[model samples]
Target: MTTYKAIKLIKRPEPGPVSPDIFEVTEKELPKAGSGEILIKQRQMSLDPAMFGWMSPDTESYIPPVELNTVMRSSGVGEVVESNHPDFEVGDRVMGMMGWQEYALSDGKGINKVQADVPDETVLSVFALPGLTATQGLLNVGKPKNGETLVVTGAAGSVGSIVGQIAKAEGLTVIGVVGSEEKANWIIDELGFDGAINYKTDDLRDQLTKLTPDGVDLYFENTGGPIQDLVVERMNAHGRVVVCGMIADYDKEVPSPGPSWVPVIKKRLTIQGFTMPDHFDQIPTLLQQLTPYVMSGKIKHRSHILEGLESAIEGLNMFFTGDNKGKLIVKL
Candidate 1:
């Protein structure tokens, strides 16, 4: 009762892909809820593409590296087991940097209570970081107009899937670029996307040309690779690109070049790379805009949950491998 399970980062990962040796699953003393604090017991934690950047020692990223021998940093949905804070009561479900641990203690800062009447898995998927990223980056940055062409890379992913759906809801024509034929079908057929291109196939540019005959007015760039190069080439005048992630480059020791700027200048493209931390203050506004879509099933999601904390090490690699069928989560 005095101790709880946690996954601690014993070593920083090398300049390549995620490996099992970097983390150690161990027991830690349960944290106490001090005055003006709330203690949380984690129910489910997300495995995101951004976590790949958190693991690399040499990577200078939007956030600092997870200090060695500490609990590996993560965000999760948790139940309040104890509370001394004025704002929170016992049994309240909250979300924040609960890390790869069974319990967390906070003073009601940086955490938001889940307000929707949905399952914990749904809250963790579209209501948390993934949904916010999609909503903000697409609407605030991409700014698609009705009947315009919208293209999304990593179209089968948690963020990309929602971005396409939101664009469709706004009456934009959505074309998804995915890694597999099944993923292509999932977005186009099941998700109501106008078209899809399988990036693993050699005819990427050809497919993009055919699907986007009108040219893309907005590109939601998630996986940066040849697919992105092709998408950028097909951009219309004054096209907007929302760079949310680069899962394709996460594992490479030496990162490759992105799409050239010559075309960017000719097309007058507006490209912005976004990190969720800088946009945390806007989550409330975003949730208000995004929650209804989720509630109405207009913004749908799929979760591929692994069974335990021990699976986190391998589960993280799924983001890069395209092995994950949906939003990867670790169910504790």
Candidate 2:
């Protein structure tokens, strides 16, 4: 029997950096594909901020918490090594929620084939959750208009970068709020953002005033912190706020208080929070909306790759540290 390593959630994490002790790594005998199922040899796994919520004990989140003693939940790109299903064949490339393991067996419910010719990195980086989230949040939820000004927090991250680029493509003035000077430069110089605010060093209000002289028309909230209030204060009347991830407060015992609702009432702002799982059924439509931007060269992406499956354990901390340059993936 062939064996493969898998990580299981043995204990619920406390409010802080993820502790390695909560997970138990073990080796198990690999199983063959059963009737109407496919076996995948996962090549790359994505590390997302959402995993923190999934690991928590909260039962009211958009998705259920990963049950203790089960494989850690994650999405990955893989190739079918064996198939008992008619729709998938051996050697077919695919992507889906395969969890933190070397091999995955699925009944072909959510799994989708990777038909694009691009490398697996691109598939996981741009076309997977990042791009899908960007499209649904910015385009469907935000409803941006041409000549409007847009500010996206966590602007250099996987989803935020795509949101800024898509806003720019739609003729909006895009300003990004990033953590470091390097990220600010990359968003402005390379991603063609109108301007960037380094939340760490820059004066948040001063830079926001200078960059968005005409009040923000759309705000893409990715990281919740001090800057969130400043951005909300500068929004135009009837502006849209798309709340995505709140990484800054993810590990805290208590999340920071949200911005006052006075402005929200006075400005008549529209605010909505969304997760990709709710929009999974519309994936084909979202991909249809996002593919043109990629095919036409408007979308550009970078990936920070870690080696081996176990590397995923430490990679989760990088989200809080802002160390990973681009889409964080573990190459197995």
Backbone collisions counted per model: 0, 0
Best-matching candidate per TM-score: 2
What stretches of model 1 exceed 4 Å from their correct place?
A: none
In order of appearance, the predictions have TM-scores of: 0.97, 0.99
Question: Which structure among the candidates has the greatest lDDT?
Answer: 2
Tens digits of per-residue lDDT for model 2, 61-169: 9999999999999999999999999999999999999999999999987788887789999998888999999999999999999999999999999999999999999
Q: How large is the C-alpha RMSD of every model relative to the true structure?
A: 1.2, 0.7
Local accuracy of candidate 1 as per-residue lDDT tens digits, 202-251: 49888889999999899998988888888889999999989999888878
- After best superposition, candidate 1 residue 70: deviation in angstroms? 1.2
Residue pair clashes in candidate 1: none
